[model samples]
Target: MSTGGGAHAAGLIRLLQSADFARAFTLAALGTGFASLLIGRTAGSVTLVTIVIALDVVGAAILFARRDELTLLRFAPTSLLAFLAWTLASTFWSFDRASTLRGWFELLAWGLLAIVIAHVRDTLQTVRALGDVMRWMLAISLGVEILSGILLDIPFPFLGVAGDIAFGGPIQGIFGTRNMLGFVAVMALITFTIEWLSQSISLRLSIFSLTLAALLAVLSASPTVLVIAVAVGAATLALALVRRSAPEHRRTTHTAIGAVVATVLIVCWFLRHLIIRLLDAASDFSIRADLWNEILDWVRPRPVQGWGWHGPWLRGDDASAPYPLNVINFTLDDRHASALNSFFDVLIQVGWGGLLLFGGMSVVAVVRSWLVAGERRSIVHAWTPLMLVALLVDSMFESFTLTGLGWMMLVVCAVRAGQSRSWRERIRDLAEGAPGGHGSGSSQDPLSGAR
Candidate 1:
C-alpha cells in the first residue's frame, strides 16, 4: 500500500512538472505582450516591454528553481552558445545605447524563456504552443485593426496614439504606423501558414484565419510586407511539398524543382528589378538607399570595430565622408529613424568581424534546425521551412536583427531543435496508443515503447 502511494505521488509530481505549465506561461506572456502592443499608450516604450519581460523572467526563474524536473538547460548545444556570444557582442556595440540596452534585456528574458521551453516540452508540443500563442496574438491584432477602422471619427482609446492616416482608409493601430502594422500582420500570416501545415486544428479554421490576416496586411498597404508575405508563402509551400514527398523521390524532385524555382525567381528579380521596384513603391526606400551608401562609405575608413557604440551617426557632422552631409541630415531629423537595413547598420557600427560572427551564428542556427527536421517527423519539422523563409524575407527590406521578433523566433527554433523526435518514435507512440495496446492496465508503461 505504501509503495502504491509513493508511486501515485511520483506520477502526480511528474504531471505537475510536464510541459503544460510552461506552455501556459508562454501563451500568457505572448498574449499579454500582444495586448499591450495593441492597446497600450506607449506601444514601444520600455514600460510595456518591461512588463512582458518581467513575466518571462519570473517563468524562467520558476523553471530553474525546479531544475531537476526540466530538461531544457541540459540541451544547450554549442551553436546556441555561439549565437548567444554574438548577440552579446552586438549588444555591446549597439549604435543606439538606450535602444541597444533594451534589446539586451529583452534577449536575456527570451533566453530564459527558451531554456524553460526546452526543458519541459518536446518539439511537437513546442510548435503547438507557438501556434497557440501566435493564433491568439493574431486574433487580438485583427480585433484591434478592425476597431481602428471602425473608430475613425473619434479617438478610440489606444487608437488615438496610432493617429489618423489617409491611405484609401484609416490605418491606425497600437504600432503607431502603417508599416509596423503591416509587418506584424505579415508575421501573423506566417504563423497562420505554419498552423495550417501542422493541422493543429481544423483546416477550415486555418484557411479562414489566414484569409483575414492577408486582408489586414493588404489594408495596411506596406509594399515591403505584402511582397515578403507572397515570397515567403511561396517558398514555404514549395519546401513543404518537398519535405512531404516519398523518400525515394524526394531528393531528386526537391533538388530539381528547388533549383528551377530559385533560378526563375533570381532571374526575374535581377533582370526586371522585381525587389527594387517593389521597394521603390515605399516613399522611404530612397532614404534607405542613401543611408546604405552612407554606411558603406563610413565603414571604409574604420573597417574594424568601425566607430564605437553610437559613434558614426552621433558624430554625424564631424565625420568626413561622401555621405557625411546625408548622415548629418538623417541624425538631426527625427522623421528618419535608424538605418532601415539591420545588416548595413551593424556593419557600419561593428565592422566585418561583428557581422561575420553574428551572421555565421545565424547560419549555424538555420543549418542545425534543418538537420534536426530531417531527422524528425514532428510539428517542428513543419516549422523549419516557414521560419527559414520568413527570415529570408525579413532580411531583404528591414533590419530584422534589430527587432525583438527576430530573437523570439530564434529562441523558438532552438528549443524545437532540442525537443524534436525521430519518426519511428512518433509512430510507435501513436501505434501503442491506438486504444488496443494495453488500455488502462499499462498506465505505468505510457512511454514503454518510446525509447
Candidate 2:
C-alpha cells in the first residue's frame, strides 16, 4: 500500500478509537438495540437482524482499535460468559442447528452491544443515553398509536397498532404487543426517574418524560406492568431506607429487608389466585398456564440439555411449520412467540442446567447492583438494581427478558453490576497494589461518579 493510503487508514483507525467516537457509538447502539422490536415489526426480521449485524460489526471494529485501553480481565462477568457459552453449546444437540446458530448470533449481537456500552460509558452516561433513546422511542410509539387510532382510524397490522387508542386502549404501540409496550414503559419510568434524581436532564423534561411513561404504561393495560410497578415502588422505598441507614448497620438492614421480602413473596404466591383476579388477569394467566403446561410436556423428555436454544419459537402463525413451539401453539390453538414465561423459555430451550446459569447470572447481578446502590453515595447507582428488579419481576409473566430490548437491557444491567462489584475487580485491585505489580489500575469504573 502507498504511504498516503497507509496514513489515511491509520488516521481513520485513530478516529474510531477516540473517546468521542466511543460515546457516539454507545448512544447509537443503545438506540438501535432498544428499538429492535419496532424495527422488526415495521420493516421485517431480516432488516432488524441486518441492522444489528451492521452495528455489531462497527462496535467490534471500535473495540478492537481501543483494545489497549481496556483491561482484559474485566471484559465481562464470568456468569454472563458461562450462560452464553452454554447457549452456544446447545447448538450441537439442537433440533435445528441452523436456527439455533442464528439465535446464538442474535444473543451475541446484543451481548456485544451491552459490553461495548459498559466499557465506554459510566452509569450516569449510560442512563442518559437510555433516557434519550426511551424518550424518542416512547414518543414515536405514542405518535404511531395516535396516528393509527385517531387520524387514520385504521389498524396498522404491520406495526401491530390495533387502532385501540380511540377506546382508551390496551394499545400495543410500536412494540408488537400491549405487554411489551408496558414493559418498555416501565423501563422508561425507571430511566426517567434516575434522570430526574441525577438532574442530568431538565426538571421540565424529566416530568414530561415521566408522564409519558406513566401514561403509556396505563394505556398499555398490561397486568404485568401493574405488578412490576408495585415491585419497583417497594424496592425504591427499601433502597431508600438502606441508603439512609448508618454504614455499619446497612448489612443488618439488608438481612431484615430480605427476610421481609421473602415472607411477602411466599404469602403472595399462596394468594396468587386472588391477586390474579384483582388484576383482572385471570384470563391472561389461564392462557399462559396452558402454554406453560404444554411447554412442560415437551421439556420432560429433554430435561437435561433441553430442546436447544431456538430463540423466538419461529415466526408466522403457520400451524404446519413443524417448529416445536409452533407445534405447541397449534395444539393449544394459540399463537405466541414465546412460552410467556422467561424461566419456562429457558427450561425448554437449554434445560435445567441453562436455567441454573441464567438464574445465577440474574441473582448475582441483582445482588451486586443492590448492594452497590445502597452503599454508593450517588443515586445513579440505584438505576441498575431497580431496572433488574423490574426485568426479573416481569420475567415471571412475560418472556420479554429472553429476547430483543429486554435481553439487551438485562445484559447491560448485568455487565454494569458486574463491573461495579465482582471478584474480577477485587482481584485486579489486589494485583494493582501488590509488590512489583505492573497493574496500572486502568479498569473502567462502572459508577465513575454521577454525570
TM-score of each predicted structure versus truth: 0.72, 0.94
lDDT of each: 0.56, 0.86
Predicted model with the maximum TM-score:
2
Worst 10 residues of 2 by lDDT: 435-444
lDDT per residue for candidate 1 within 1-451, as digits (tens), equals 9999999977755554555655676666555544554534544445666776677766666565556543432345455565455545655554445644444565566566665555555555555666676666556555665555455534455444332333343353555456656776776776666677677768987888778677667766676776677776676666666667776886686578668778977896676555566556635666776667766877897686644333123212234322333464555453333456656755765677656755664665555455444434554455654565566566656664444555555565654543342233444556877532222122121121221
Tens digit per residue, CA lDDT, model 2, 77-138:
88889999999999999878988887888889988988888877888888998999889999
True-vs-predicted CA distance for residue 8, candidate 2, Å: 1.9
Q: Can you tell me which runs of candidate 2 are displaced by over 4 Å?
A: 317-323, 428-451
Question: What is the TM-score of candidate 1?
Answer: 0.72
